[model samples]
Target: MAKLYFRYGLGKSAQLCQVAYNYFEQRNMEIAVINAKDNETIRSRIVVDGKNVLVREPNFDLKPGVSLYEKIYLRDSDVGLKCILVDNAEYLKEEQAEDLFYISKMLDIPVIAYGNRLIDEKKTSLGVCRLMALADDIEKIDMSMPSKRATLDFNYGAMNCSKTAQLLTKDQSLIDEGFKTCIIKPKLDRDELYIASRIGLRKKADIILDLDDNIYGQAEYLYRDRINHILVDEAQFLTPRQIEQLRRIVNDYNMPISCYGLKSDFLSNLFPGSQRLLEISDNIYKMNTVCSCGCGANFNVRKDRFDNYVTEGEQVCIDQGDNYDSECALCFMEHVMKIDTASRKRVRKK
Candidate 1:
């Protein structure tokens, strides 16, 4: 049976796609590639087996137009008759994702989507969320490094460091050292900024913030295309309404949608969208980030121009007014207390 495959990971999906492509090509099967507009440009330059293969751009404007399958097949009859391979398949809109899924199922052709599991720096796996419901086969490729001492200035003696340290230590000695040695928690503020930047570079969606213009159109497109599996990135930023729309695509259309993004904000507070995702999502996976002290960094802290911790600030601070770092809850509390003590001393001096 044809199945909608959502392969999610950090660049691992790309490796998997390469493997899958090789497997089919070994059988001398023909493949057609599809991707988002931005990816299509770069994907066109990718040579699979030295065959100048190009991922065609998806035409989102389906109004008064023929179906995507008909359009592609009409342009090149070989695609409809032969096997197809899509790179960066996660960039497809809901309608496009669903359409490809249906083609794989009804036509008995395998449709594979390669994409990141998480969309944010927190390493929340968006691809995993979207694929869990639809995937018949799921494989996790761990591309993370071993946890080590952090470069930040802070104490992390009481923070969590077991899981990440274990990943770093192949033998018992390193693991023992990791546990005994204090490690700093990973900083969330800097990570979120990095994520936002990457999204700016990779996202091809015309409607990034305006849901009515882009999201609804994408949803309607997905319904029309009959997509089987949906893959989404930066899902943490998705509004509650957007999540509901995705849920509707899943429940009403019976399409499985996977999303990736942070579960919480820099301040360790749940993002409105992430909160909804936690409630609605079927499977949850955590990617690891280590604090400067070499411990698991769970909380995000903002800093000012003097590198002093700022507990109260705007939720989104894009301007580089000061530096930021990731710290453990314990460290964050300590900083908070220190700030309070300093304020009290200043009052006394006055």
Candidate 2:
């Protein structure tokens, strides 16, 4: 019995969504799609790397999974729908959401709603709020919505967070369970650090992602053929909106996604992406790394060519001109920011 999922899109997660839809379609599983999104989002699937995956379109037939109004005229035995998918669910009315529940209970199929969100955040509206409360399972990820569905797994630490290596160790387990997995490789991650080939994830990622451009159509096209779970490297670069979108993707598709990256940037600022993951993820993990001080480390600092801490610079510098290293938050502040947080804490204690 599939549970209702309230999936949201963060950043440019629209494309990754199609991949999951395609996966379900390939398995011959029935699905429903409803939408209140005003902008006529391109729901068509575009082939990527030569695959015929399904995209944003709902594949449900009226015979089994009809619209709310459509079900009114028919008897329960006449409907054969397996799943109900609604887009732009924010536009629904509280009564409409209630109708869905009645329909779902009668049909014994899952009802999924899609909306735009910034990770764990939601817009307060009578309709959406009512729907959230009525959902059997609120999954914001590949697991459950409301950070309760599946689990939002996280792995964070300093530079070269060994999380990638650890995630690889879990690959065989997924394979053993008859699950197919793919990694989200951002195009901007062209640096040596983001190279899949260098990261032991050679050939693991079946798709390459360009956050600048929407890839939802292509993902749907490809995943319609195969894919089960998702993995992402350099998730710190992801925007809060994108993280929400990924969370929704996992929920709608029923796949687990693992994100690995630094918790904070060199200046100790929370990367927008990491902040959202921390706020909404179900399972959080910290990858281990040593700082320059040799004590247990988690913070990061940018360095100049002369091995000096670079204080003034852009937030994201992919160019080889800048370098980064891991350090403790205390060292990052005292040695880099020169704030001496230890002293501040000591004085505040008094």
Candidate 3:
């Protein structure tokens, strides 16, 4: 039997698994990628390494201790799958992980599981740590590195991003134009200006201040019938789901929503919230800035107190001494990543 492996990562675990699946398939290995979610609403196809990777909804009964991939393998006279993958395995209960382990032993096929360290607290045994305890081998992946950074900031202006100051100015202008604008910021963003929000991250933002952070709980502070526009600051700290919720509010309330945030993190990875904004925002605008290399830049980098580049750590450290700046993709790849300039692909302006 192929060994069972648990793959855990920060921020990019899902993408990591997808990349692995693609690699295996390219090598002429048969693989069954299963979606563990009971609803599995996300079936969108993704283009990876220039090839199509479809998100397949699992056809098996996905409940704990009930996985039976062997039957499906036998019934289909197709390429024999050497391995099976459980994407979003954190959603599975402990018993479900057990089931997969048992199935792997019985079928003599590897079962690879992927999940992030973050977990929904409401769950019973779906915690990622629990599943890790049951795996034959464990692999943890994180692109973040410790800072040799002089300053750690999410300065988009340096990266050709629309400036936060510009966003605020626009909001003030709209407010002056007789628009009822509500401005809010995520607690994660450490701007000189601050706003209070819920203890945890929220998807929706149309509410007033309250001890509780939900719309209904904060109803005393908001006039649902009176809001004319919504402006969000430090929006990069929000969850992707929250970005969609803001969109729904914009339509349902018949108001416009403007969000300003870093499109990607210091590691040049997309923030979940910013990515959602890119996907569904009505209008996307860039406040461009110039890089030190004299090219227009749009990527952020992290440096340590000693001014050395730091490449290890989590994607976010809300208040660290590290420094951040923007650079062109080419320069960042060359200077920070040490990629050969000749091998670097020219990054075109958006």
Best by lDDT: 2
Off by over 4 Å in 2: 1-149, 191-204, 215-219, 340-350
Superposed by TM-score, candidate 2 places the C-alpha of residue 94 at a distance from the truth, in angstroms, of 36
Find the candidate with the highest TM-score and give its number: 2
- Per-model TM values vs. the true structure: 0.38, 0.53, 0.47
Position 131, candidate 3: lDDT: 48
Ranking the candidates on lDDT from highest down gives 2, 3, 1
lDDT tens string, model 3, 245-309?
66666555445667777776776566766655644554445557768978666567888888988
Q: After superposition, how far is residue 287 of candidate 3 from its true place, in Å?
A: 1.6
Model 2 sits at a Cα RMSD from the real structure of 19.3
* Stretches of candidate 3 exceeding 4 Å from the true structure: 1-162, 191-225, 342-350
lDDT of 1 by residue, 1-350 (tens): 45556654455434544654575456655555554434443233446898745433332233222455544444334333354545454444544554454454345466666554444423444333433323333333445663332211100111232332332232234335442211111123344312223223221222244333335446566556544344444555567777666666555555555455554445545566665665454444544456676645545567788877776767667777866565543354357424232232122111
**Whole-model lDDT per candidate:** 0.45, 0.59, 0.55
lDDT of 2 by residue, 46-142 (tens): 4568753434654333232335544531433354455666766666766666656545543445676765432225434455555544444444443
Clashes of 1: 28
